[model samples]
Target: MLNKDCHHNCNQGNCPFAQDSNNANRYVCLKCGVEREINRYPSGFGSIVMLLLSLFIASQLLINWEKQDNQPQSEPAISSLR
Candidate 1:
């Protein structure tokens, strides 16, 4: 499946044979004339989810920081001598 219009052994993402599933059995690349199998990019959903979770935590921290900054500081009250 990665054998579409390839001439050289280009291992870039633009390589046509990167996502060829049925070719998993094949050791040769049809596109770039290489004996190596084309590399494929994996799904990104996991990384995206992690990124969103981190962003949410960071925003919560920022909000808390702002609240603390806006609150007035109070001094300790003096106790009367016994």
Candidate 2:
């Protein structure tokens, strides 16, 4: 039999899995009784590769902008009237 408070709501504000279990066990948050696992942050070489790729894209965009800014505009040629 579940406790009066053990009527696991699992609602948005009341996450049953996040609460203390019968055996005093800690569980992850749940959405509508469904258990949710905590997501771990990226580490190791994957993070490094992502950082390098982002930097390369940013640098390329910056270089393109600089080139466009430095480009010179041509003036229209005027003809002399006889």
Q: If scored against the real structure, what TM-score would every candidate get?
A: 0.42, 0.38
* Residue range with the least summed lDDT across 10 consecutive positions in model 2: 33-42
Cα shift from native, residue 74, model 2 (Å):
4.0
State each model's CA lDDT, in order.
Answer: 0.64, 0.61
TM-score of 2: 0.38
Q: Please write out the lDDT profile of model 1 over residues 17-64, one tens digit for every residue.
A: 343466663354455754544344334866798899999999999999
Candidate 2, residue 9: Cα displacement in angstroms equals 44
Candidate 1 Cα lDDT to native: 0.64
Residue 54, model 2: lDDT of: 100
Backbone clashes in each candidate structure, one number apiece? Answer: 2, 0
Off by over 4 Å in 1: 1-42
Can you give the lDDT of residue 61 in candidate 2? 100
